[model samples]
Target: MQYRWGSAWGGQRLLGTENIEVAIINRGRPLRSVVLEIRGRSPNGLPPVRMFQEIEELPRNREVRFELASYEMPDEIEELNLSIVSSTAVE
Candidate 1:
């Protein structure tokens, strides 16, 4: 699995914006649902942030973009980590 920042606006990425966009690519089997765990530290001197998102019916060899918005948006994400908490494989 691979992930990167995504932008809804053409060619204009929101690097330091309130809303964060993440693009996830599925390189393996199809999934009925998947839970992604995200952890990062903000540059605003606040505590580390943790977030989770559940994607449904993701097909193989596909990419999806999810927007993350919380009470505080990190000006810059550091030591960011993404993990798969749970997933249902579609046979």
Candidate 2:
């Protein structure tokens, strides 16, 4: 899994927000579902914000992309952490 951050736009004007793009490559086997947890800190030094997303029916040796929620661009998120919350295999 790999993650990247970029500015989000609604149209011509900037939405003044940022969003994350995740790429997941299934190697071992097919999966029925996968839950991912994203955690990051704010620029203001406040508590971290976390979000979760679930992807279903992923096939083996396939790559999938996911777009996460948009957040304030100036949040100055220092680091991003991605974890596999849960996964189910396809039998």
Q: What is the model-wide C-alpha lDDT for candidate 1? A: 0.74
Cα lDDT tens digits, model 1, 17-73, are 546678888898998778989887867777887888898867888888887763455
Best by lDDT: 1
lDDT of 2 by residue, 1-91 (tens): 4444443333322442556555667776787778888787766787786878788866787777777656433355666687878888887
Q: Show model 1 residue runs off by greater than 4 Å.
A: 6-15, 70-76
- Reference-based TM-score, model 2: 0.66
Pairs clashing within candidate 2: none
- Candidate 1: the clashing residue pairs are none
- Single out the weakest 10-residue window by summed lDDT for candidate 2: 7-16
* Sliding window of 10 residues with minimal summed lDDT for model 1: 5-14
TM-score of 1: 0.77
Candidate 2, superposed: residue stretches over 4 Å from native: 1-16, 72-74
